[model samples]
Target chain A: MIEQYLLHLFIIACVYAILAMSLNLAVGFTGLLNLGHVAFYAIGAYTSALLAVGLGVPFWGGMLAGGCMAALFGYLLSFPTVRLKGDYLVLGTLGFTIIVEAVLKNWASLTRGPLGIAGIPKPRLLGLSLSPLPAYALLALAAALLTYWLLSLVVASPFGRTLKAIRDDEVAAGALGKDTFRAKAKALALSAFLAGVAGALYAHYITFIDPSSFSITETILIFSMVLVGGTASLLGSVAGAALLVLLPEPLRFLPIPSDIVGGMRQAIYALLLVLVILKRPQGLLGEDTLRDAWARARRRRKGA
Target chain B: MDILPQLIMNGLIAGSVYALMAAGFSLMYGLQRFMNVAHGATYLVGAFAAYACARLAGMPLALSFAIAVLVATGLGVAINQLVYVPLQRQKEKDRALLLASFGVFLLVEAIILMVFGADVKSFGLPVRKGMDVLGAVVTPVQLVIILAAPLVFLGLWLFLYRTRTGTALRAAADNEAIARTMGVNVRAMTTLTTALGSALAGVAGILVALEQNLEHSMGLPAVLKGLTAAIIGGIGNVPAAILGGYLLGLAENLGIWYLPSGYKDAIAFVILILFLLVRPQGFFGTRRREEAGG
Candidate 1:
């Protein structure tokens, strides 16, 4: 029983790790403060769940479709708002999330409203279904590892360097002949794709998908995970995801009423977020990337 | 009565409250340059304080309102000092401030939920008879909202234009560094801005609670609507925010006349996106070439 609980915890941690890593790519690496990331996650979950349940598509195909759909949305959304600075872009993403939520809740014919879609079948690899806890955990772990590997490769590549450049000083990057707009769009798309995959995995594992799961609160949670882990650090993302996912488990073991447990968990996260941002904006494992970037930009401005 | 006129009246009533919220929000954002997500929590606390005063403490309505405003104003200043001041001192990025404010909002909301439970609370005031104006019926409370909103705007306008502190606030808004050089107490002005802004939010909260019902989650929607208005009118422009609020209210109400009423909330977001894409600086705001380079 203990092993099963630990495995369950591990699976959740892995899923959140994937989410945090993806969000870190846009927010931490590319400097896109996206607040509507959960919209893509919702799209991915709904797409994969609908395709598999509605059209009998297999898990892999459904997940791919979900990722592609979310990527498309990310790319499209980036076009109009790519020129917006800071808080305006954040508001734009926020508006997008609200619109997506509104559509999901109101478009009952398509999404079934708040009733949600249920009974998502687990994935099968080579006719061996991963239904058991251990197998599911392994699959989640594999997915997380693949995400980490691919993301690391992207970060190591010239494309990743360009993204960082754009993040640090868009004007300077542009002066150096880099297409900052295209780079930002690509980063957003990649981030959305990964978030979609995580969403798909979560849907299949839980065998349920709902609008409530993709609320702004979920986006904020993923964001906080990235911050806690340390921006621009892959290991930091993993550590943050693990710590946060495990942090609330002790609450469950406590004798407190279940009703207030959720609120307390949220309160804890809020406190942690405020303390971290105020005292250590670089995050626990972060290397002062954002501050360094800002300082560099200011220095460049002074020089010019 | 024609449904159109009634809807317009209803829209105006709602718009007034939204305008009040947007004015305060815009003032803070214009000067501080950070999106204070905790502003919504101030609204929630205001209503809760009013509820506590009138219902739990059995205070009179006027006294309760005064107490609620004071509570909200104090909370706003406290949040500024506790959460934002330290971050500003650290020279944290705008995104960090934004995220921290989000955290503050969540923390406040969680505390409210723990203390008040998830149940909806009403002001528990006696219902008044509906009065007709130009064939549209409105309750006395709503009429107060409609009448009071313009007065609030006038008051704000006068305060900003006629008062010494208001000039300091505006100077700070224009350029904080220059204002400081000019001997404006930037800290005091900011505190005053927060106090006034939060007081407006408190007024809006009480009015909204009296008109509808109070729930912990109402903050998000209130903030979102006020934000939409602020963005539409221009982020930092006070008068424009008021106009934007009315426009949003009218658009939502009129649009719902044709579409499903459930889509009313979505209208603000759609407008926000449209404004961001087509004309981000908004009607009253001048376009900055530097900002456009991003």
Candidate 2:
């Protein structure tokens, strides 16, 4: 039983790691400040869930479809709101999430409203169903490694460096002849595509898809993991996901009301987030020198 | 036509409450230039505190309201001292402050859930029948809100424009360094401003509770709406905040009549996006910072 639980945790953490890493592309590298990122997650989850559960499509096909759909949505959304900066973008993304949530809740013809879609078929490799604990864990592990390798490559590529440049200073990048809009659009599309694939995997793994499962609060949690791990490092997002996803299960052993227990666990997480931000805003692995330089520049500008 | 009057009356009452809430939210943002997401938590707590005092302790309505305001104000001050002030002093990352505030919001919300549970509570105040005003129904509470909201706005405007303390706050908001150089205790002003702003939110919460049920999740919507109003009217514009609040309230209420009720939140976002695309500085906001700096 203990081993089974650990396997379950491992599977869940791998999925979250995928999510955190994809989010890091937009939030960490691009500095887009998207507060409603879970919309794509929902889109991917619903797309894959409907395909596998309703249309009887296989898991791999559903995953690809889900990712493509999310990317399409991301590209479309980026066109209108690309010019917004900081809080404006935050509000826009938040608005996008709300709209998606409304559609998910009200459009019962497709999503079945709050009843949700369940009993999704797990992935099969070579006509052998890998639905068991050990098999699922292995599958998730492979996905995590693949995602990590791909993300590492992207962040290392010149295109990825362009995203970082835009994040650092869009105006400066523009002055240096880089099309800031094109860079941001590509970053957003890539981030959404990754998040969509993660959602597809999550939907198949959990065998259920519900609107409540992908909420603004869930987005916050995902964002928190990215922040806690510190941005700009593949290792950090995976570590954050593993730590956060697996931390609270043992606390259920304590003799407390389920509600209070959930509340307490969230409180502890919140406290940790507060402490991390207060002490080290750049995150765990962030270079303090760069942060200091930015601070100094802002201060000098203010003084002037 | 009759429905029109009723909608207008309902919109005015709803807008009045929103105006009060946005006034508090905008004042703090103008002074500090940080979105205190935790203010929503304070609003929720204030409503629950009033509910507890009124229903559980059987206190008088006025006394309950006062206690709620005081508690929320104290909590706001405590937050400034414990969380916000420390971070500001350290001069940490801007997003760091936002994340910390989100954490605090989560913490306070969790605590409220633990203490109050998820059940909605009400004060069961004496429900006065609505009076027919030009073929529209207006409850006494709505009337009071309409009258009191503008009075509060007037008071705030007078305080900001006519008083020395108000001038100090405006000066600090406009240029914190210059204000500090001019011997304004910038820290004290920010603290006071935060406390006062949150207390006003507490008042708005109570007023909102008088009309709607008080629940743990109330703060989230209030924060969103208040922030929308502030952003629409320009982040730091006081009078614009009030105007934006009324506009949002009317737009939302009338939108439910014209469009589907499900799109209520969507309407606010559409307006927000429009403002972002067209007039980022807001209706009455000066292009001081954007022009001077950017």
Candidate 3:
């Protein structure tokens, strides 16, 4: 039983790790605060879940479809919002989340509304279906590792440098002949695609999909993981995910009511977020070099 | 015509709450340039505190409300000192601060849930019967708020537009560095703005609880609506925020009445999106400055 629970925890952490990394790509690497990222996650989950359950598609195909759909939506959304900056972008993303949530809840014929979609089939590998515990844990771990590897590669590449350049100063990047809009669109699409993949994994693993699961609360949780782990850094996402996912399970063992336990878990995460921001707003693993560069850039702009 | 008048009355009552919520939200945005996602949590805290004082202390509803307001004011100050100040001094990423505010919001809500449980808690006071005015039927609390909201708006307007402290606040919000260079205490201004904004959120929460049932999640919708109102009115304009709140309230009530109830929350977002696309400057915002393009 304990081993089974550990596997469940591991899988959950892996899913969150994917989410954190995706957000880091947009916010940390591109410097765009897309608060409605969960909309993409929801799109992926619903897309994959519907394909698998309604159409009898294989899990792999469903996951791919989910990622593609999310990326497509991200690309579309970026056309309008990518032109805006800072708080405006934040508002745009937030609006996206609310609109998506409304659609999810209202489109009951497709989504089943608050009742949710359940009994999703497990992924079959080599013509064999493993127990959900091992199946989901392995899948999540693989995804997490792959996402981290991909993100690290992207962050280290010349394209990654350009993204960082855009993040630091879009005007400078534009002046340097880079297409600022295209760069932001690409980053947002990549981030949304990964988030959708994570959502697909979560849907199949949890064997349920509901509008409630993808609310602003989940967005906050993902944001906490990224902030705690340090935004824009690969290792930061993993560490933050692991800590946030596992911390609450042990707390659940205490002799508290379920509601209270849930509240305590939220509280612990919140306090951690506050403390982290108050002390090391850059993140635990984020280097000072990045911050100093930003400060210098701001100073330069002010002087200019 | 009767239905219209009744809807209009309902809108006015709802608008008062939105105005209260947005006033603080806009003020905080102006001063700190940070989105306090936790503003909703402060609203919940105020409601719960009021509920608790009324239930546990056996205080009169009015006194309990006053106590709630006081507690909420204290919470606002605490948030500013503990969260906003530290973050500003550190000069950390705004995203981090945003996440941190969300954390505080969740934490405070969780604490409320632990104390109050998941069930919706009420003041245990009897629901006041409605009064018929010409063609519209309105409850006493709703009537009070309808009257009080405009008064609050007027009072806030006078305070901000007519007072010395208000001038300082506006100066600091317009440009903190310039204000500091000019010998204005930017730190004090930020702290005061946060405190005042939070207090407004708390008061709004209490008023909302008086009209509706109190729940841990009430803050989420309240804050979201308040944000929508603020965005529509202009993020930094005091009078614009008040007008935005009423307009949003009317839009929401009318939307729910005419459209499917499920589309209620979506109404705000729809308006927000339309505004973002058509007029990002908002109702009262001045000319759009050059964006950073990042």
TM-score to native of every candidate shown: 0.95, 0.93, 0.93
Q: Please identify model 3 stretches exceeding 4 Å from their true place.
A: A287-304, B175-184, B288-294
TM-score (0 to 1) of chain B for each candidate: 0.97, 0.94, 0.94
Off by over 4 Å in 1: A289-304, B291-293
lDDT of 3 by residue, A108-190 (tens): 99989888899887788889885468876887889999999999999899888899999888889999999988988999999
The better candidate by TM-score, 1 or 2, is: 1
Number of the top-ranking candidate, with TM-score as the measure: 1
Best by DockQ: 1
**DockQ (Cα-based) per candidate?**
0.68, 0.43, 0.59
lDDT assessment of candidate 2: 0.82
Candidate order by decreasing lDDT: 1, 3, 2
Which is the better candidate, 2 or 3, if ranked by DockQ?
Answer: 3
What is the clash count for each candidate, in the order shown?
Answer: 0, 0, 0
For model 2, the stretches where C-alpha displacement exceeds 4 angstroms are A287-304, B89-92, B126-129, B288-294
For model 1, residues B98-197, the per-residue Cα lDDT tens digits are: 8888999999888888788788888766898898888889999899999988998999999999999889899999899999999999988898898989
Error of 2 at A285 (Å): 3.3
Residue B24's lDDT in candidate 3: 84
lDDT of 3 by residue, B190-238 (tens): 8788778887888888888777888888888888889889889987777
True contacts kept of each: 0.72, 0.50, 0.81
Docking class of 2: acceptable
